[model samples]
Target: MRRLALVAALALSANAYPAQAQAVAETADPYIWLEDIYSPRAMAWVEAENARSLAVLKADPQFAGFYADALKIAEATDRIAMPRQIGGQIANLWQDGTHVHGLWRITSPAEYEKAEPAWQTLLDLDALSAAEKANWVWAGADCEPTAERRCLVALSDGGEDANIQREFDLATRSFVSGGFTLPKSKQWVSWETPDSLIAARDWGAGTMTASGYPFVVKRVKRGAPLEAASEVFRGKPDDVFVIPRTFTDGAGHSEVVIMRGITFFEAEFVRVTPQGTTPIAVPRKSTVTGLTQGRLIFQVNEDWTPAGGQPISAGSLVAVDPAGKAAPEVIFAPGPRQSVDADEVAVTQGHVLAAVYDNVRGRAMRFTRTASGWQQSVLPLPDNAAISMVSSDRASNTAYVSVQSYLLPTALWKVDAAAGTAIQIKQTPARFAADGLVTEQFMATSKDGTKVPYFITHRADMPLTGTTPTLMTAYGGFQISYTPAYSGVTGKLWLERGGAYVVANIRGGGEFGPAWHEAGLKTKRQVIYDDFAAVAEDLMARKITSPQKLGIYGGSNGGLLMGVELIQRPELFGAVSIQIPLLDMLRYEKLSAGASWVGEYGTMANPDEKAFWLKTSPYSNLKPGAPYPETLIWTTTKDDRVGPVQARKFAARMKEYGLPYLYYESTAGGHGAGANLKEKAMTIALEMVYFQRRLMDTK
Candidate 1:
C-alpha cells in the first residue's frame, strides 16, 4: 500500500501575519508536483488513480447496462437540433454515433421547419480530426458584418480553452488559404476591417496577466506577423484581461470599443474612433450587450452613482450615447424581485427583444426606441418556463426563442420582434417517459430567517418514508439563477429508477436578483452554505429522504460548494460529487485563470481574508482524524478555465489523510469533462454507478 503522506511537503507564505501563525496555517503541500499537469511523474500518478477507481466502479454488475443506456440517450437522433439563424440560413451543430465530434451544418428555414430537415454539412470535425491526427472542438465563429460570407472560425484542441483562429469562406465552404490565421493561444479576436482584426493573445512574457490571460490588445493586419500587429491598448499585469469589442447595430452602424477588464466584475470601456479613443460614461461593473439604433446598451452589475447623475440600481439595463458621451438612460429597471437571467438583447431590423426573469421565472419584452424614451411590450410566453432568444440577425425581424421547464422538453418559438408575435416552430421529442413524474417548488428557512426556494422532482405517488434515494444539487454563486431545466439523462437514469432530484435556489444566486447574490458575497458566503444546508435539512424534516440515501453533486463553483458540504456536514450526505472545482483556495491566485475570480472570492492578501481562508480552504482543512463521506472528484487535464491542479491536490491531500475518495482525470476535454459525447456518457455512467452503490444498493 502507498503511504498517503509519504511525498508531502508543506510551505508557508507570510502575508501580513505573524511568522508563527503563518507557519502553522500554511504547509508546503507535498502534492504541488501535481500542478505540473503533463509531467511524467504526475501523469503516472493520475493513470494509477484512474485505473484503480475504474476497476472498482466498472466492475459493478450494472456498469455495462448503465453505459449502454447513457450512450443511447446521448446519441439519440430524435434530439432537437438547436438552430441559429445566420446569413438567412438556419445553422446547427450536431453530433451522433456517426458524427462524434459534431458537424457544423446549415439548412433553409423552410426545410428546418420540416419533420426532418435536410442539412448540408459545412465542416465535419471528426473528419478533420482524423485527417490532422488531432482532437479539434469548435470554439465559435464570428462572421463578417455585411456579407456574412467570410468568418473567423475558432477551433480548440481537445476542447481546451486555447484555440487557433482561421478565416473561412462560407461560399466555398472551406478554410481560406493565405487568409487570416492566428496560432493556437488563449486569445480574443474581433473583426475590424476586411483585412484587419483586433486581437489579444500571449505576445511572449509580460503580455499576460497573473491568471495566464492576455492583457494587451493589438491590431493584426491580414498577412502580418503577430509581433508586427499595432498596439491598440495595454492593461496592467494585475488586470484580469483586455480585449476589443465591436458592436454593429441593425442599421449597419459599427463601433469599436476597448474593454480593459480591471477585475472579473469590473471594466473600463473606451469607444474607439478614427480621431482617437474616448471614454464612455458607464459603471465599472457593467457589460455592454449590443448597440441598438446607434445607442450603446449595457447591463449594470453594480449600483452606479455617476459623477453628475442620480444613483442607478444594480441589475438595471441602461443605454448610453457614445457620440454625446452623456449620462446613461435607464432602458429597463428590474424590480426588487426581478433579474435579467438570460440577458437577451437582440437588435432586429426594427426593434430590440429583451428577456427578463422575475423570481427565477422568465419573460420576454420588446423595447422600441422612441423620441421620448424606450417603450416596453411584454411578449406572450408561458409562465414558469425558462426563455432564451437563441438566434436573431440585424437583417431580419424574426428571432428564435426557446422555452422549457423541468418536465417539458424545449419548444422552439419563432418570434417576430416587430409584431411581438411568437409562433411555435419546432420541439424536441420526449426522450424519457414523464407520465408519473411531478415537479413542485418549496421554500426552506435559512439561518438568517431567509426563505430559500428549492424544487423537487419525483413520482407523484412517492411515499414520505424518509428512505427515497435522492440526488440534490445547486450552484449558488456568480449570480446565476437556477431555473427549471430539462435533463433526459436524470429523467431516465435516476428518476425512472425511483430516485428523486432536488435543485436548491439559495442565496448567492440571481433568483431574487442582485440582492440575493449580494447577501452572500466574500466573507459573508457562509450564508450561501447555510442556505444549502437548510434545504438538505428541510428535505429530511419533510421525510423525503434520509442521510443514508442522499447524495449531492455540483460542478465549477457548485463543485466548491460540494467540497464545503463534504467537510462541514459529512453526516448529512451519503456521497458527494465534486467536478472541476477550486479546492485549495489559498494558492488559487497562482493557478490558471484563478486570479480573475478574486472579485467573487476575496483574496488572501488581506489578513482578515487570509484568516477566513485558513479556516475554510477545503484542502487545508482535511484533518487526519475527521470522518469524510466517500467522495467522487473528477476533472480534465485540458481544463484551463479552473485548472485540474486544484482537484489533483485535493485528492492527494485526501489520500495523505487516508480519507475515502475516487479520483478521475481525463487527458482532454477542457472546462467540460469531455470533448465528445461518448466521453460525457462514460463519465455520467461512472457517476450513476457510484451514486447507485451508495444511495440505492446500500439503502
Candidate 2:
C-alpha cells in the first residue's frame, strides 16, 4: 500500500497569483524550468506540449475510431492469459501484435487446463529488446521458491521503476552467464539461498531513501561484487523503503523478512536470523502477509495488542509464530463491510488465499490451520464478481482466481486450493455490448456526513434527464481499493459510445477499511476532497450527470484526485482527466517518489501540514481566468514514480495562466500513461478524445 503517488507548491496570495502568477506567490517556482527533466529547456517544452496536444487530440473525427478501438483492445490475443503459479509451470506475460516486448511464458499445470495451452517461451521480451539495444520493460520474476528453476529477471527501462536484475535460467532457457546481475536502482531482490541474495538496492552513495527507495539491506553471494555486498539491514535516511522478503513454507519453514518502510502507511517488520535482526511483533500498521504452517501471516493496518495477548481488530487477519511461541491467532476478522485484499494475499500449500472485500464485492477466503482452531472456507467464488488472486502455488494448493463485474466478462477461476473448489478456467471474449449495461451501487452523501460508495456503468433504459455523457473516477489515495473491474477500454472507448462511467467509493479508499483509509489522512485531506465532491454532487443530484454533463478522471493517487476536483470543485467538472499527476502540494517533497509520501502527505515540516498545503494545493488552487474544466493534463516522460516534475510544473502554470489546459508527455510510460501497447493505445486515444471533447461536444 505504499504506492502513495504525488503533489507540490504555492504559498498562495497576490490575489492567488496571475501576473505570471506572481512568480508563484513571489519568487522562485516560475515554472522551475519545468524541473529540468531532460533539459534543453525541458525537451523544448516537451516537444511543444506533445505537438500541441497531439494536434487537437489526433484531429478528432473520432480519432481514427479511438485509435482503432484502443489498438484492438490492446492487441487482444483472446486477452486473459493471466495465470502465474510457476511451479509445475503456468507463469505468463504474453502481449500481442506479435510480442511487443513480452512473451515470458511457461505452461504445464496440465497444459494450463487445456483450451489451447502449450506455451513455453520463457523470455522473449521482443527478442531481448532487439538483442539488448534495450527498451526492455517487463519488471517481474523472482523464481527460486525452492528451485522453480533459478530466476530473478526484472528488466524495466522504458517503463522505468529502475530495474535490471537478470540471472535467469529455467532449465537453461538462457541468461546466467556470470550470473546475478543487479545493475539498476529501485531494487528489492529475494531468494536468500540457492546461492544467496537478500538485497534492497543502490548500495553506493549513503544507500538511498529520501524516497528514491532502497534503505540498504544486502547479502548478495552468487558471484558477489555488488561492491562486495554484506550490510544486512539499515533503514533510516528518511526511511520509506527497505524491502527484502523471502518467506518459504513448503514443509521447510525458511525466513528472511525485513520490510522497514516507515511511512506511506507505516512499517517495520524484521526477522532475518543467522543470529540477528528480530523486531516483528507486528503493527506499525501491519503487513507481513504470507507463510503458512510455520505461521507469520499478519495484515492488521492498526489495532493490535500483543505483550500478553487478545485484541486484534483493524482489518484483522493475524497468525504470528515467527518462533515467538504462538498466541496470535485470529486469521480473518473483517466484516464491518470487510477488506483484506492486501494485493490479493496468497500463501497456499495448505491454504491462506484471502481476497475478501465484502461490500466492494469480491470473494475468496480459504484460511486453514487445523487441530481445533483456524478454519474459514468461502472460496466457491463467483457472486457480484471482482475476486482476483490469480496465482498462488507455494508448492501447490494450486490457485488462480480472476472473476469480473461492471457488465461481467472476465472469468478464469481454477482454484482447488485443497478443494474449497473453483473451476471455470478462462473466459473473456465479450469486449463490449453488455446488452443494456446496468451495474448499480450508489450511496453518495459526503460533505462530512460521510457515506460515499459509487459505481454507475449506465444506459439501463437511459434518460434520468440530465444529458448523460458522464465519466468520473477516483482513487482517493493509497489504501487503493477502487474496485469494479471489467474495462476493455471502458467498454470500447466510452461505454460503447453512449458514455457514463463513475467509480468513486472515495474517503481515501480501500473501499471501507483502516477506517476508510484513516478517514483521509495527513491534515485530513478534506475528507478526500469531500469524498470526490460527493461523487460529483451525487451525480448531479441523480439526474445522473450535469454541470454540463460532467467528466473527471484520475491517475497516480488519482492524479492527485484530478488535481483536487480541478481546484476544489470548479463548477463540478465538465472534463478534467489529469493523469499521472500530483499538482504541487508545496513542492511535493522535492518531487519524484515525493519523499516517500511523508506518511501519506503531511510534513511541510508540519505546521498543520503547512496549513493543509496552503488550503489544499492543486498547483496552489490554479486560479487565473477561473471557471476551469478543459483539463487533459497528462504526464509520463519516463515518470520515475510521480516525476515528470509535477506534470511539468502544472503544465507550466497553465501556460502562465492564459489558462485553458491540454498538455501531454509520454515518451514511454513509467508512472503509467503508456509504455507499450502502442503506448497504451495512444494514452487511450488521448483520453477518449479528451472525453469526447468534454462530455460529448455540442457546446
Candidate 3:
C-alpha cells in the first residue's frame, strides 16, 4: 500500500490540466513527478474533492434532510463484527478547522459495559462545542489474547497541543506499550515464541543482519531475555528440532542439530549436547535437505552436471543416526531413469513416509518404508491437472497437495497414502458467475526461442476483435509457480467489469522445476522479460486485446516486470499498477532488504552482473524525453522486504522527467498495504476502479 499523503496529492494531480501539472511538478520531488500527476494520488484527491462537493450539495434544503437521514441510518447500523463493518476504524477528525485527537476501540461485552457510563457521560456533555464532539471517532478493537478483556485504542491527535491525554484515562488499562529498536533493516518483524520476537532485517550488499532472537522480553513479568537461554550457532540457522529424553544416546549427550545450507552440495550440521557443540558430517556432494525426527535426510544426485555452476541431478533419501557413528542407510531409492526429490518426509512408529516429486515426469510420487524395505506408489492425478505436494501428516499418514491446471481452478486435496487416492478437500470458490469465464492455454516464443507457457482468461462470448480491455499479470522469478486460483474481489472487480486477465508462465519460475527457474535468472534475466513481452504480443495477435486496451500489474519481483515493460514498450499498456517494485537496480544492492534477492537476481558487486542488471532495471532505463504509460507505483513505509525508498526515488525521477504516473505510500502496514481484511479489500477496489476507468476509456 502506498502512503495516504502521497495518494491525496496524486489523486488531485491525476486529472489536473497541463497548466496545473507544472505547478504540482514544482512542489513534488522529480523522482515521482510523472506518477504524482495521474496515479492513485490523483484518484484519492478526486474523492476528497468530491467529499467537499457533497458537503456543498448538503446545503440545499432537498439534500439537507436526505443527508441527515442517511447519517442517522449509517450510525444506527454501525455495529461491530458485521461483515460490512469488521476492521473498520475512525482514521481522522477535524473540529472548528483545527484537527483534534481521536482513538479507535473494540471492547468485549464485559469491558463495553464497564466503559458505557463513561462513554455516555462524554457524549452527554452536549454543552461542549461541536469541535470537541467531532474530535472523537471509534477506531476498533484489538482481538489479541490478554489477561483482562480490553478495548483497543489509538492516539490520533495531541502531537503537541490539546489536553487529550486525559481522554485516554478510561482506556489506559488496556494499553501495553514498549519499544525495541531493530538492529538491522528488515522487510518484516514478527513474534514467534510466546515471549520471543524475531525480525528479518535486510542490510544491503548481500549481507543480512539480525537482532532480537537474542533480546529482552517485554510485557512479561516472569519472562527472561531470549539470549539468556538461547545458543547461537556458527552457520545460518535453518530449522530447530527438540529431541525426546527417551531417545538420548546415554553419553549424557542429547542431540540438538542446526542444519546450514552452504551450497546445494554442502550442508553443515552442528550438534549440541550437554557438553558442547560438535560438528557432524553426513553425505556431501549431494542435496541433503528436509527434516524428520532424529534424522537428517540426504538426497544425492545420480548424475552430477553443473547448470549455471550449480549441481543438478536425481537422487535418493538417506538417514543417519544421532550418534554420527555409522554409515547412512538408504531409506528410499529413485526409480530408474527417473530422479526424485523428497518434497516432504515424516516419521511414525517404526515407519517413514516420504512425498517425492519427479521433475522428469511432472507428477508426484510417494514412498513408504517398513522393517523390510521400501514400497513405492504412484498417486492419482486429476485429468490435465498437476499436483505439487506441500506436506504430510505422519500421524494420519495423509499428505496435502495443491492441484491446478489452465482450465481448472486450484483445489487442495488430502491424499490417503494407503489407498493411493486423492480426496478433494477444499477449493477456492468462484466469487462471480463462471458461466461466461474461459481460460485457454497458449505458448509464446521468447527472444532466444524459449517456449513459454501462459494462460489467458476472459469473457467466453467476447469477440476476437482486438478491442477488449485486458489485464495481464505475471511473476516469472524465484522459481515460484503462478498457480491458477480463484480470487473473489479480483473476479468481481476486474473480470466482471469486462476485463480479460492473463497469467504468463515465463521462465525463472518453478513451473517445470529448478531448470525452468534457472533459465531466466542472472545473465539470463532478459529471457523472463522477453517471455512476458511475447505473451503480451500473442494476446494482441490473437485479437483478444490491443496495446491501447491492455493494462499490466505485478508486485515485488513481478514489480520489476512491470517497470521493465513500461519502459521497453510504453505503448503496450494503457495503465500499469506496480506494487512494492524493485526499480533501482544500481542502488538496489545498497538498500535495506535488497540483498536477500541476490540469489535470484545476482549481486551487482561484479561489473558484469552490474552491467546486465543496469541494462534491464527500469530505474536505470527511465529516459528524460520518452513517453511512458500512466503508472501507479504503490509501496509502504513499513515494507521490510523491499524498501519504499525505491518507489520514492523512482517516482521522484519520473516526475523530474515529466512522465505521467502516481506514487502512493502507506505510512503503516509492513510490506503489504493493509493490516486487516477490509483494508485489503479497499486497496483492491481502488485498483479496480483505476484500471477499469482508464483501460475501458481507450478508443
Candidate 4:
C-alpha cells in the first residue's frame, strides 16, 4: 500500500506539472539573476530579436490580403469626425463597417441635415446587402440639446416597425429602444425618451405601456375597465432638478407648480403660489438637471464658477408644490466645511438620506431627515479598510458596501441602514483547502528605502522551501488600487490548482491614498516596477516560492508593466500573460487611440519625458540570448478603446525571437472582453483553461 501511494504521487507530480520546472531547480530571488541572463551592455542584440520578429510577420503574404479585406468595408463607409474629451482630436469615423448600417450620434441640427449626403452615399455602397440598407430606417439620426425639445425625423420607410430609438450624449452613445416581440412588429406605441420631462402609461388588453412624455391624463372608454391610472416618474431621477430663470426669482428660487395625475378630469395640484411660496435665495450660477422622479433639485454655488466646481460649499433642495402657494423648503444644508455632491443624497418616501464621505478622516457618515430635524450617524466600517458605498435598495431597506484592505480580499456586506447593523453577504470563495491557503503582508524596501506594502497568497500545505508555483498580478497606474475583489477566473484555476497568487499594492496605485498614486507616475514610474520586484523577492526570502515557478500577468498599463519586467528580468518569471499590453512606447503616442493615455503616461513630445519613458519602455529593452518567458498575448479587433494593433505588433516581435508564445485575438468584442453574458463567460473560461494548462504542469 505504501509503495502504491508513493508511485501515485510521483506519477502525478511528473506528468501533471509544467514540463519546464525540471530545468531550473535552484531556489533564488528571480531579480538577483537578471544580470546573468540580460545583457544591458549588448543592447543591440535585443533590438535585433525585435526586428527579426517584425520581419517574419510582415513577410507573410496572407497577412496583407487579410487586412485588405478587413479594411475594405471600413473604407466604403462615409466617415465623419466625432469629438472626444480625453484623447485630443479623437474621431469616430463611421463607415459601412458598422453592422447597424445608419448614421449614429448626430450632434446638432446642422449635422443632421448634413448627414443626408452621407446617408445617400451609404445607400449607394454596392457592398452592402439590401437588408442592411433597410436596417438604416430604424436608426434615429439626431439628438436635440434640451430635454424639453423633441426632434422627430420621418423614417425613409413610412412604417411603425422602423426601429427608432433615443441616444444619450455619454461617451458610449448608449441608446434606449422600445422593446417589441418581433423585429418588424407594427404595434405602434409611444415611449418616453431619456430626455423626456414627464412620463405617462396606458393600459391596453391587460398590458401597460408608456403613452408619451410631458404626460396628460386621459379618460377611459366605456365598457373597457382597468385599474386606477396615473402619470408617475419612470426612472430614478436625479437629486437636483433645475428650472429656467424665467420661472425663478432674482435669487433663483422659482414659484413652481407640480401636478400629479389623479383622475382624467381632476388632478392633485401642489403649487408654490407667489402668496404662499416665498422667494428663497439661490446662487445665480446654479444649474438644474431634472431627476428621474418629479422632484426638482438644483445645485447653488456662491462663486460664479460652475456649481460643479470644487467642493466645500453649501447647497439646498427646493421641492416645488403643484398648488402655486407653498414655497420650496431647504431639506439639506452643507455641513461646516464639508461639501455634498448631487450623488450623496438618496430620496425615499418623502424623506432624503445622504451618505457623506469625510475627506478628512477617510470615513463616511449617513444623515437622514426626521420630523424633529436632520439625524446623523457614523457608518460601521473597519478602521483600516477602505469603504465604497455602491447602491441602496429602498424597497428592501438594505445598502450594499464593499470593504477591502492590504491584508484582505474584498468582502461585500449588506448593511441595514435603519438598524445600523452589517451582515457579510458574500466572500471570495476559497479556491484551495483552508490548510493549503496562506496570506502574508510584507513591506518591501524600494531604492529610496520607502516601505511598499504587498500581499501574497500561497499553498500553506506546501513546504516553505521556495519551490511552489506562483503568479503575481499588479496594476500600478491611473491611481487604481488592486483590490481583492472576487474573481471567478483567478479563484478557480490559479489558486485551487496548488498554485500561489500575489497582489502587489505598489506605488502609482491609490491603495493608501492620492499621495501614494502620485509617487510612482511619469518620471517616477520605475518605482512601481521596483516595488513589484521587491514583493517577488520577499516571497523568495520567506521560502514561499522560487523564480522558476513565478509567472506575471497584467493588462492595459499593467500590460506595460509585464512587458518591461520581461525585458528587464527575463529569468524572473517562467511564463507571462500580456493581454492588450501597451507596447511600442515611442510610437504609442501615434497609434489610433494611444494619444489619450499621454496624460496618465507622460507624453514623448517633451525631451525630458521621452528620456524617462525610454528608460522603462519594454520595447526599447528587448535583448538577444536572453531566456524570455513563454508569453501569451490576447486582444480584440473590435477594441476601439485600446487598438488591437498594439498586441499584434508585440506578438509579431516575440515570434521573431523564436520564443514560445500564443496569440489569440477575438474578432468581435470591444475593449471589454465580450459584449454579452455568454461571450463573457466563454472568455473567462478560456483564460482559466489557458493559465491552468500552462502553470499546472511540472515535468
Best by lDDT: 1
Model 1 lDDT per residue over 610-676, tens place: 7867766677666664556789999999998998999999999788879899998888899976998
* Tens-digit lDDT string for candidate 3 (1-699): 223243333331111133322333335334432233236764464345334433433343433333333233223222121111111211111111111122232332223223121121212111232545532222222221111122223221101111121111123432334322232221222222223322222223332232111111112111443233343333342211111111211122223444444432244555545565576555443444433445555655343432223332445566655566654556665554233434444433223444443322245555554556456666676643455555443234455666665435556665666666777655644445567888777887877887777777788898899989998898988756675655544555567767788888888765654567667767778778888888988898899987778889998889888888876666567789998888877666556545546657776777777767555667766666565666787765545557576777677677778977765655444456543333344345456655755687446
Candidate 2, residue 474: Cα displacement in angstroms equals 2.0
For candidate 4, write residues 1-699 as lDDT tens digits: 013233233321111222222222122312222112124532233345435533543344433433343244223333223321111111122434444333333243223224332321212212232635532333223222223123222232321222333323333333224311112211222222322221122223322212111233222221223243233322111111111111222122332333332221112333333344233333443333222123444444332222333332334434433232433334444553233344434433223344332221123445444556446666676543446564443233355566654334556555666666676654443322445466665777866687777666666577788778788889888656665443434544566667777888788765554456667767778788778877777777878776667778888788888887776555456678887678767667655445545555777778777766555565544443346656767665545445566666566556665656666655444564543233344445444444544455543
RMSD (CA, angstroms), candidate 4: 19.6
The candidate with the higher lDDT, 2 or 4, is 2
| Lowest lDDT 10-residue stretch of candidate 2 | 1-10
The TM-score values for the models, in the order shown, are 0.95, 0.32, 0.62, 0.52
Candidates sorted by TM-score, best first: 1, 3, 4, 2
- How many clashing residue pairs appear in each of the predictions shown? 6, 13, 39, 35
